[model samples]
Target: MEKANSSVPKPRKTSVLSNYEISVSIAFKRDCEVFLVEFAKQKTLSYAKFANIWQLKNMSYIFADQTYVSLLKTLCEECFAILTQCIIHQKNVYMKIGALYLLYGLYYKQPIEGMVKIRVSYDEYTIIKDLMDEMAKEKYMEPLFIFAKLKADVAFNYVGCSMPRSIRFIKNTKKAFTAHTLNANFGENPLSKFEGILQDESVVKLQDTCKRYEMALKKNSSIYPNIDQFKSTIMDDLNAAHKKLFSEDHSTPSEQIETDLKILNSRQEIKLRALKSENATYRGAKQVLTAIDLE
Candidate 1:
């Protein structure tokens, strides 16, 4: 009789997080209630705007809170999972960038006592690497590059080393390219000053965001041909409509002024209603409304 064939089973892959790690992650997420509440309250703010406002207005009180350092430390530990969920599951670019910003602040401001280590399983590492690659191909270049750079910084800092200058150089190049495109497109405007009053960083960060968006649009131009023409057409129509509405018909100066004021007020009210509806629909539309009450 022939000998029976024998086969050996492959070992199953396990999670990178240990039981302690899992427990700590759960506790940390629970502790994020305060952060979540703050986020929801200001969910309409852009990440940069929110960060700037928090730094100027609330940083001191937040630092004095007993749970602040602990929350930062927990976030540092769980940064990978948080970023992954934001990028992959939630598809929220702002949240992904926000999580990285939180991790970056934690690294600089509140240093942990001992060596804080992050260990990734082979499978998990592969998943992250693939995600980064996919984002790169999709022209989501800014966040993809930033996340990679930040992840390396977090990992190396935990082990008491600096990331190589070469990696930093590459990341900076990507950021500059996006920023340059935006600055060229928008030019300088008096409107930036108006935006600065509520959130000082909004204007600067908005330029950067616009550059990234412009690049994305250009990359997918085949699907959105005549976008620039469309914008010009809309602006021309708006200007013509405005001129028709406020045309001076040889009325008395005071009467003309009063009529103009009424037209402006009516237009402002319509804009405010539209802005509120937009805020309800989008995550950060309120920040776009310069006339909204920031208080």
Candidate 2:
């Protein structure tokens, strides 16, 4: 097996490459049966394989290059389907524990850009909440990677432009053009407070109209997202309140959404947001080294 190398020194906790990881790398090219036998006996293969898979140093190159599109395309549909099935079968505790480790390995090893759609669904708040809860419990070094990705996606993708009122050009236009009292005011619900529009009914009608137009535009103003585009699943699981509220809210202007998206898209800086900690920093520090150790 080829030993992993990087420009930076490996942190003390994650310094050595494990035998199971080496075997898995070997298995990636060679014999699966041999590796599985070793994995059962040692329990080390799973750990090392996963660790090697999500190694941050190796991912530095992808982050350095701007191949966002390439990264998105690399996600293997077949593999993701299998992973999702595994997640669905397990209990939440086991799911949270095992999935975080498994995903970290997959993420680090593959380092695919725009590849997050496979591991976890961002739209599913429960999945995000549980995974986060699990992370809060202990010194989970690996789960941090997924959390960073999620925060970046939320900050730049969901919270940033998804709300609409946060954009600059729209703010200026509202000031110059719209005299509607609500037009300039962004209410507490950032999504609803955009320029000159506040009535939920009016917003929903506008959104329905826009959805129609967007459908047309995609099909050269002819086609729309249809049954074929979606999986056959129960729509009943969707909350009616959310649907009603979504309908009532006017979309933040498309231009604003596009602009905010562009800002996130063009971002080159690495996104690093920490997960919430159950232990206070001092407590964590105390566990690491008692008063005598600092000296």
Candidate 3:
């Protein structure tokens, strides 16, 4: 009698790509084939080539088509492998830098989780990381400084805080007058009392330093300014902000405040550095592309 009450098992669920997704996959594969053909001949990638191969429309398909996603992962791995080889073999610096630009573009295009994991031996990872670090240390600072300014805006928004009119005034001041004006009037303003409450040192320093870097970059377009300047400036700003926010006289800060501060300092620094390095590589790629007519 109990056997008579048994129910039928349900069928396993499966996903299928839509007709549009299938078409996207076909178009993407064709593009990859074209890119591979060019890559085979030149043994390097360029910004224009990469932009042509990786169209914005194709990128939109990555999330919708599992097959396309897998294909993209495969493509990224192949490019990364080429990058590793370029570095390991000590190939032409221009080619190596070009490969790096392509790799960064791919890595930044989609979410890391969606992309294939970079499968590298520990030693390989170390070598690549070291190279990247060296490059970052010597990267142009203007882009990073600009990123820092944007980071400050995001950080203030994170903690539901807004800059005072005095800070805004400092930001809008002419570059020649900014530093002097800030030094003289910063502490005297009524808003200065709220600096501790607002935790605006990082924002202020970021804007000020960005302006300085902008001027410097404009003056010396050929020189690759060291990124260490930005790091030092931001670190000092963060330290000052930290001391103000958690003065010895104050009670222990809440976990949220601590987390936000960490994000503003560490995460923002990491992001700015990465952006700087990527941009430098991209610029180098453009130069190399111009040197060698791919047509």
User: Can you write out model 2's per-residue Cα lDDT over 10-119, one digit (the tens) per residue?
Assistant: 76552122332233233231221221222233233234443332332242233344244433332332223233333433343333334444444444445554454443
lDDT of each: 0.45, 0.39, 0.44
TM-score order of candidates, top first: 1, 3, 2
lDDT of 3 by residue, 1-295 (tens): 3675347777755323233334543444334333333333333334444343344225334434345555555445444444444444443433344444444555555544644543455565456556656556877343234324433433112211111244323332111212122111222334335446434676667768768886776666556555333223554675677676556545322333344445556766887898878336554456455545866
RMSD of each: 23.7, 28.0, 30.3
How many clashes in candidate 3?
0
Q: Which regions in candidate 3 have their CA more than 4 angstroms from the true location? A: 1-72, 110-113, 136-295
Winner of 2 and 3 under lDDT: 3
Against the true structure, whose TM-score is highest?
1
Give every collision pair in model 3: none
What are the per-residue Cα lDDT tens digits for candidate 1 across 5-108?
Answer: 55756677644333334555554433332233333334442454445434533433422433555554544556434433333332333443444444444444
TM-scores of the models, in the order given: 0.31, 0.26, 0.26
Model 2 spans with C-alpha error above 4 angstroms? 1-49, 52-75, 92-96, 108-116, 119-124, 139-141, 153-295
